[model samples]
Target chain A: LAKTTQPISMDSYEGQEVNITCSHNNIATNDYITWYQQFPSQGPRFIIQGYKTKVTNEVASLFIPADRKSSTLSLPRVSLSDTAVYYCLVDYNQGGKLIFGQGTELSVKP
Target chain B: EPEVTQTPSHQVTQMGQEVILRCVPISNHLYFYWYRQILGQKVEFLVSFYNNEISEKSEIFDDQFSVERPDGSNFTLKIRSTKLEDSAMYFCASSDEGSRNDEQFFGPGTRLTVL
Candidate 1:
C-alpha cells in the first residue's frame, strides 16, 4: 500500500465540474489507484479505478499521468447530493489491508 | 448487481459482553473484508478473509476480535469482550477475482454501540 495525499476539503456549485487530485509519489508498479465516495451514515462506494492513463465511467473519470505518481478524479456537473467524503487509495491487491486516510470532504453548494 | 449484506443493522452490548456481527459477501466474490470507523475517525481495516481463512489482519484485530466463515454464505466477526472503544460502525466488503484492480463492494454497515 502507498500513502496518498489529498486536500482536506473542497467546495463546488451545482452544475459545475469538480476535480480532486491525489498524490502518491511512492506508488508501486503493481499498485492500482482507486477512488471511493462515502456519504453520511453510509459505507463507501467505489467511484473509479485506474492503473495508468485515463478511464471513464458513467459516474466519473480517472486520469493518471505516464509517471503514475498521481491521479485525479473528475466529477462533471456536480449536484448538492454529491456532497460527501472522497477517498483515494493505492492498493497492491495481494490481500493487503485496505486502510483509508482522512478523505477529502466535498461540499456542493446550491 | 449483487451487494454485501450485514445482519442486526445495529447492536448494543455492555462492556465485557460478547457480541457477534454477521455479513454475507457477494456470491461470486473471492475476498471478504471487515472495516470499522469510529465516530469522527477514518475507516480502519480489521481483517480480510479468503478461502474460508484469514489472509491478513490489522493490529487492531487483537486477541479479542475473531472472524469466521461458518457457512458458505455467512461471514462473522465476534468480539470476545466488548469495550467502550468497540463502539463503531463495522462494514463488510467483498471483491471478485481477488486483485487490486478488482472493485470491492461494501455493505451498508452495522452500527455497534458498546456501553
Candidate 2:
C-alpha cells in the first residue's frame, strides 16, 4: 500500500469549490487513486476515483497528474451538507482491504 | 439503491464476553469486509471475505476474531472475548466485485461498547 498525506482540515463556504490534495510519492503502477467521504457517525462513502488525468462524477472530480505522485479531490459549489471527512486511498486494482489514514476534514459553512 | 445493513445499532457487553455482529449486504454484492474505528481515530480494516472464505485480514484480526456467512445474505463477525480496547464502531461493507473500481457500500455501523 502506498502511504498518503493530506491536510488535517479545510474550511470552505457554501457555493465555493473545495479542493483537497493528497500526496503519495511512492505510488505503484498498479495503484489506483480513490476518494471517500465520511460524515459524522456514518460509514465512508465513495466519491470519485482516478488513475491519471481527470475523472468527473455527479458528486465530485478527481485530478491526477501524470506523475501519479499526488491527486486532488474537487467538490464544486459546496453545501453545508458536504461537511465531512474526505479520505484518499491508493491501492491495487485487486481490491482486498482499505487502509485508511487520518483523512482531511472538510468544513462547509453556510 | 441497494445498501448494506447491520443489526443492533449499538451493543454493550462486559469484558471477556463474546459478541456477534450481523450484517446483510447488498443482494448482488459478492465481497464482504469488516472495519472498525475507535473514537477520534482512523478507520481500520479487520478482514475481507469472498466465496465463503477469507481473502485477507489485518494484524488487528487476531485469533479472537472470526467471520462467517452462515447463509446466503448474512455475514457475521464474532469476537470470542471482549476487551476494553475492542470498543469501537464496527462497520460492514460489501461490493459487487473485489476490484479497485468496484464501489463498496457500507452499513450504518454497530457501536460496540465494552464495560
Candidate 3:
C-alpha cells in the first residue's frame, strides 16, 4: 500500500466549497485514490474514487493531476452535516493490506 | 440498499475475558474486513476475510485474535483475552468484490471497553 499525507483539519462554512487535498508521492500505477467520510460514532462512508483526471459524484469531486502523485476532494455547497473526518486512501486495484492515515477533520460552521 | 450490520452496539468486559464481535456484511458482498479506532486516533485495519479464509491481516492482529464465519450470514471477530488497550470502536465492513477499487460499506461499529 502507498502512504498518503493530508491536512489534519479544515474549516468551512455552509454553502461554501471545501477542497481537501492529499499527497501520495509514492503512488503506484495500479493504486487508486479513494476517499471516505466518517462522522462521530459512525463508520467511514465511501464518497468518491478515481484513478486519474477528474471524477464527480453526488457527494464530491476528485481531481488528479497528470502526475497522479496528488489528488483533491472537492465538496460543493457544503452543509453543517458535512462536518466529519475525511480520509484519503491509496491502494492497489486488487486490494490487500489497506492502511488509513489520520483523516482530515472537516468542520462546517454555520 | 444493503448495509452491514453489527450486534452489541457496546460491550464492556473485564481484563483477560474473551469477547466476540459479530457482523453481518452486505448480503452480496464477498469481502469482509474488520477495523478499529482508538479514541481520537486513526482507523486501523485488522484483517480481511474472503471465501471463508483470511486474505490478509495487519501486525495489530496478534495470536489472541481470530475470525470465523460461523454461519453463511455472519462474520465474527474473537479476542481471546481483552486488555485495557483493547478499548476501541470495532467496525465491520464489506464489499461486493474483493478488489480495493470497489467500495466497502461499513457498519455503525461496536464499542468495546475493557477494564
Candidate 4:
C-alpha cells in the first residue's frame, strides 16, 4: 500500500473554495485517488475519486496531474455543514484495506 | 438512498466477556467490511468478507475476532473475549460486487466500551 500525506487542518470561510492536497510519491499505476469526508460521530462518507486528470461530482471535484504523484480535493462554495475531517486515500484496489492518515480537518466558518 | 444499518448502536461489556455486533448491509451489496476507530485515532480496517468467506483481514483481527453471515440479511462480528484495548467505535460497511467503482457504504457504527 502507498502512504499518503495531507494537511492536518485547514480553515475556510463559507462560500469560498477549499482545496486540500495529498502527496503520494510512490503511487502505483493501479492506485486510485479517493477522498472521504467524516463528520463527528458519523462514518466517513465518500466524496470523490479519480484515476487521472479531473473528475467532478455533485459534492466535490478531484484533480490529478499527469505525474499522479499528488492530487487535490476541491470543495466549491463551502458551507458550515462542510466542516469535517477530510481523508485522502490511495491504492483503494489493493488488499481491500483503506489505510487512513490523520486527515485534514477543514473548518468552514460562517 | 440505501443505507447500512447496525444494531444496539452502543455496547458495554466487562473484560474477558464476549460481545457480538450486528449489521444489516444494503440489500444488493455483496462485499462486507469491518473497521474500527479508537477515540481521536484514525480508522483502521479489521477485515473484509465476500462470497461467504473472508477475502482479507488485518493484523488487528486476531484469533479472538470472528465474523459470520449467519443468514441472508445479517452479518455479525463476534469477539470471544473483550479487552480494555478493544474499546472503540466499530463500523460496518458494504459494497456492490464486481463494480469497477465499488464505493463502500458505512453504517452508523456501534460504540463498544469494555470495562
Model 4 TM-score (2 dp): 0.96
Error of 2 at A51 (Å): 1.0
Stretches of candidate 3 off by over 4 Å are none
Best model per DockQ: 2
List model 3 lDDT by residue over A1-110, tens digit each.
Answer: 44899999999999999999999999988889999999999999999999999999888999999999999999999999999999999955346545789989999999
User: Model 2: residues >4 Å from true position, as ranges?
Assistant: none
lDDT of each: 0.91, 0.93, 0.92, 0.91
Model 1 alpha-carbon drift over 4 Å, by segment? A93-96
Q: Which candidate, 2 or 3, would have the higher DockQ against the true structure?
A: 2
lDDT of 1 by residue, B71-99 (tens): 88989999999999999999999988556
Query: TM-scores of the models, in the given order?
Result: 0.96, 0.97, 0.97, 0.96
Residues B59-88 of candidate 4 have per-residue lDDT tens digits of 999999999999998999999999999999
Candidate 3 lDDT, B1-115, residue by residue in tens: 7889998999999999999999999988889999999989999999999999999888899999999999989999999999999999999999978776888899999999999
TM-score of chain B of 4: 0.96
lDDT of 3: 0.92
Q: What is the DockQ of each candidate?
A: 0.67, 0.68, 0.67, 0.57
The fraction of correct interface contacts reproduced by each prediction comes to 0.68, 0.70, 0.74, 0.48
> What does the lDDT read for residue A13 in candidate 2?
100
Looking at candidate 1, what is the lDDT of residue A80? 97
Standalone chain B TM-score for every prediction: 0.97, 0.98, 0.98, 0.96
